[model samples]
Target: MSSMKYKSSEEFHDHLLGAIEKKRGYHLKRFEEHKSEQDKGAVDALAWAYTLIKFGKGNIKK
Candidate 1:
């Protein structure tokens, strides 16, 4: 069997959530910086991060 990086499922879930949150924060900052320029790509990335976090928060279980 393959080895698991996380000690347990809850740990993995928390890690995943943290990663998504970090991405969201990064994209939010980028979006703010580019908002004056009307950057579509930055907006899309921020939206994607928001959607992923929303879904992940609702669907993932410990």
Candidate 2:
């Protein structure tokens, strides 16, 4: 993985997108271990992306 310090925030956020996919697969695999979906879903990557944009990670305005 590329280090965030060396990459632009745009690059870092792009890389984070891929990581999010992998994380979803991992979390899905552990479904049985979770007592409730809510416990595993305080927020997903897509939601965070909106946050990143809205609060100022990407290009969207608040």
Candidate 3:
């Protein structure tokens, strides 16, 4: 028996997409806040988040 809330693969993908979008928003805010400080890690995180979002969106379409 699975304890997961999503019962279908599409639902699971949607959940993942929502999670990634939330995290991407966080990373974007962090990058903005630390931009003036030249935070390398923040920039990298933001870039990775964007990449993940793009990949997720692409996968969800198929």
Candidate 4:
């Protein structure tokens, strides 16, 4: 029996696009909210800090 399981590369690409659509709105909202170098840099730094704190394997506790 045949199924809609993305049997080909093109089919897989098209199938997952709708999932990304939901994030598109959030992406644009974030882009509009931060239109300054300092604002963008701060946001980026917060992300980096969060990654270090959460996934740093407790190495950056100092």
Candidate 5:
């Protein structure tokens, strides 16, 4: 939901780092789930959704 747009890898990387920092169960689990995705688009979409959940619609950029 972030207004800030990110490249796919950027989204994934940010979420992964955020997960590490926050240590939220779902965030960490989601990061791992997305990490194993072989399709780039699926991974990107997963990252985008996770970023939205972690950062909200306008609070941060990926």
Candidate 6:
């Protein structure tokens, strides 16, 4: 990891994309925990469904 500070929103966004792409398990678990904690029932369910339908067919690379 680089010791670089995000100077702009775009930089932060890109950094987040790279982090999520690299740390799949961490991000997924965090999302699940956050959704449960917040009690975002229907919205979270729909998002999960869309994620499965959108990315379910792709090959996972580690």
TM-score of 3: 0.53
Instruction: Give candidates' CA RMSD values in order.
Output: 5.0, 5.4, 5.0, 12.3, 11.5, 10.4
lDDT of 4 by residue, 1-62 (tens): 87566556555544444444444445445757876665455556655544454454424221
lDDT for residue 22 in candidate 6, whole number 0-100: 49
> Any idea what lDDT model 5 has?
0.56
Candidate order, TM-score descending: 3, 1, 2, 4, 6, 5
Pairs in steric clash, model 5:
none
Q: Would you list the rank order by lDDT, best first?
A: 1, 3, 2, 5, 6, 4
Residue 48 deviation, candidate 4, in Å?
0.2
Regions of candidate 5 where Cα sits further than 4 Å from its true position: 1-38, 57-62
Give the deviation of candidate 2 from the true structure as CA RMSD: 5.4
Q: Give lDDT: candidate 3, residue 8.
A: 66
| Residues 1-62 of candidate 3: C-alpha lDDT, one tens digit per residue | 87677666677767766776676567667668776444546556656865776566646432
lDDT of 2 by residue, 27-50 (tens): 655654774575356336545654
Worst 10 residues of 1 by lDDT: 36-45
Candidate 5 displacement at residue 50 in angstroms: 0.5
- For each of the candidates, give the backbone clash count: 0, 1, 0, 0, 0, 0
Q: Number of clashes in model 1?
A: 0
* Model 1's TM-score against the true structure: 0.53
Candidate 1 positional error at 21, Å: 0.4
Compared with the true structure, all predictions reach lDDT values of 0.65, 0.57, 0.64, 0.50, 0.56, 0.53
Better of 1 and 3 by lDDT: 1
